[model samples]
Target: MSNLTDMEIFARVVSAGSMSAAGREMNLSPAVISKRIRRLEDKLGTRLLQRTTRQIAMTESGLGFYERVVAILASVEEAEAFVSRGSAQARGTLKVAAPTSFGRLHIAPHLGDFLSQNPDLSVSLDLDDGFVDIVGEGYDLAIRIAELSDSSLVARKLAPVHRILVASPAYIAKFGVPASIEDMAENHVCLAAANQDPWRLMGPEGVVTVRTGAPVKTNSSEVVRECLLAGVGIALRSTWDIGPELRDGRLRLILPQYRASKDVGLHAVYPSRRFLPAKVRVFIDYFAGLYGASPYWDTGLETWLGPVEEARAS
Candidate 1:
């Protein structure tokens, strides 16, 4: 317990960047903070930090020790929260990362309700469309919409992310709908996020890959959707993104028979399954419950598009 306290004090000192700052934050004197850190270093038999009148910096050993201590303190906090508060009452700051458009459209709107449910809890949501290094960035959880590759992280499937080849009626009327997968390049422009990922479609016969010759390539999904709406070209789009447009007849599925075979699905991913933090666990459950089996966005479209089959996690 004394060591744990010392560890916590050391972490605070590092975070605060000075003994005086840490002392002020903890309502202790600089001398006392210095003494605690010294005791900790003596006990460990190594210099943890190099201090001067101007600045302080961690030694190589200190950096390694700090990482381990942070994990230990976090585990301790999680255990106490679970034992004392029960699983339902989750508190603390949960740092989550998600795709920008999806996070803004789906997750952000529902965050209010989740926060209301857990009064003691606060959340930090980082919205990035590009693939994020969850562990490297110290994210508590990440909401990914992709067929997950083999990873050390634990994933909870929230829902199926069915993507369909789509074009606006205006674009289809002008360019003429692609009669076949091979006809895509000759007839219409292909809007892609990344130029490398060609359209992989699964048809009655088998799988067919088509490169539409990146006429309009952009990294942003929002830009792709905008270009699609403006009759820029045919693009494979998430049903979640264009559900309303499809239902209202603004956008129509081009190749109704063939669908994008990429087995991408919505997932709530975290670092580990063991001793999971209550805050992260509850947020995952809450978000999953909100989406259900058939998300509200993907609702009503089944009437015209036929039953949408959900892809399961492998």
Candidate 2:
């Protein structure tokens, strides 16, 4: 228990960036904070920090140890929260990872309501274009928009995703709509980013792979969207992404007969199903309710997108 207390104090000192600040936060005097630091250093038999009048600097060993210590402290907090508060009560920082565009567009907008409901919980939402190491990175959950599943993490479906070909009305007016898939492939310009090549679209005649001759290719999905809206070319996009545009007539669904494979959907993934933290549970449930079988994005798209098939995470 003393060791754990020392570790917590050490972490607090590092975070607060000064012994005086840490002492203030922990309600301990600077003398006590300094003594605890010395005790920790003596037990480890190494200098974790370089002490000086101006500012403290972490040694090379201290930098690595600090990283591990923060993760350990987070784990300790989670365990205590679970044991003391029970699974029904959420009172810890909920670290979450999500895709960049989707998180900003969808999840971020609704965080106010989620946080208001679970006032005891705080959230750390990290958005990136790539998948994260959920368990290894100490994330409480992740939001995925993909066709595949990770064997290690448990996932729940939030909404069905429909990736369909779309183009600005002006572009279709100028180039004329493709009569068939082959016509589109031969004639129209397709827009895609890195790792989004060789379109794997599911059509009435099973799956068809179309190689893209993209005029405007970039690494950002937002760039793809901008180009699509500017009438640059036809690109495949999820309804959640361009739903408003489709509804407002800024974009029109081309190749409406073919769409993304049924495997693609919006999912909330976490490390395990057993003993799901209440913070994680409420966030997932809130999103599931926000975008159930009929998501807000697909509400007024009956004429454009037609009927959507029910998708669930297994």
lDDT, residue 145, model 1: 90
Q: What is the TM-score of each candidate against the true structure?
A: 0.79, 0.73
Instruction: List model 1 lDDT by residue over 149-229, tens digit each.
Output: 987678999987778889999898898888887788666798877733677876665677877655676777798889999
What's the residue-level lDDT of 14 in candidate 2? 79
**Deviation in Å, model 2, residue 150 alpha carbon:** 4.6
* Cand. 2 Cα-lDDT: 0.82
* RMSD for each of the candidates: 4.4, 6.1
Off by over 4 Å in 2: 1-87, 307-314
lDDT of 2 by residue, 99-208 (tens): 89999999899889898989998999999988697754668789998876447568899998878899999899899898999999998998888778888877767778
